[model samples]
Target: MSAPTYIYKLVSFSSPVPDPLPEKLPLSELDVASGFIHMSTPLQVPRTLKRFFAEDPRIYILRVKYSTVEKNIKWEDSKGEVPGEVGAEGMFAHIYNRGLGTTEIESVAIWERNRDWDEPLKKAESWLVY
Candidate 1:
C-alpha cells in the first residue's frame, strides 16, 4: 500500500507563532503528560474536535504530510490514552519528536465556530484509512 500522504494536528487558534503554526509545534498538556504527539486521521478530526476541543473559538488544524516527518512518524495503538475518539482501541499516528521535533508543515487552516470547518472536515474525512 502507498504511504499516507498526510496526518492532522489541532492547535489552539492563538498559536505561539503569529502564523497558524510554528516551526515545531508545542505539544498539548495531554501530549506532554503522555510523552507523545497525538495526531488524527481525517476521519478522526471531527469527532476529536467535538469531544476534546469543546466549544473553543479558534482551533487551528495542521495538515502534516508524510514527507515532512517520514522517519519520525509512527502508527501505533493509541491504547485508549488520548481523551477523544483517538483514545479508542485503534492505531493512530504518533510523531515521536520530543520537544520542538521535526515535522514538515504542509498547510494550516482555521476551524472556528460558525465558520469554515466544513470544507476542512470534508477534506479530513478523505484521509481515513485503516
Candidate 2:
C-alpha cells in the first residue's frame, strides 16, 4: 500500500518504546483500555492535546505513514466529534492492530510548551524533524 502522508502520535517520557527505538513498539495501557490506538492529524492535535495532554511538561510528536498501520487502521466517525451530535463523519483515525515501531515513524520532534504550543502544530507537515 502507498504510505499515508502522515499521522501523529503523542508521547511522554514514559510512553512505551525501546531504546534506539524498536521495530514494533508496544501499546500503552491507555491504548488497551480504549481498544484502539488514538492518533491525530495536524488539524486535530490542538484539541487532542488540550483534552488529553493538558499541562504536560513534555510532549513528543511522531510522524508516521499509513502503510505502517494500514492493515489494522480504521477511519471512523467520532460520537462526540462535533458536540451535541450522535455520529460524526471521518473525524478520527484509529489503529485496529497491535502496536507500532520506530521504523514506521518517519520523523520525531520534541514539542516544548514554551514554543509554538499556541498554534500546537498548525500543520502536520510543518515540523522540523530531528
Q: List per-candidate RMSD values in Å.
A: 4.9, 5.4
Could you tell me which residue pairs clash in candidate 2? none
Per-candidate TM-scores read 0.69, 0.72
Model 2 lDDT per residue over 1-130, tens place: 2234677888865563345777777777777787888776656667777777777766877777756676776665543133221112346667775677776788676665654367545443356321
lDDT of 2 at 15: 69
Runs in model 1 deviating more than 4 A are: 14-17, 79-89, 98-103, 115-130
Ten-residue stretch with the least lDDT total in model 1: 80-89
lDDT of 1 by residue, 11-127 (tens): 765553336345565678878876777787765677777777766676877677756666766667664244322224466778776433334766666666655456555654544
Alpha-carbon local distance difference test for all models: 0.63, 0.63
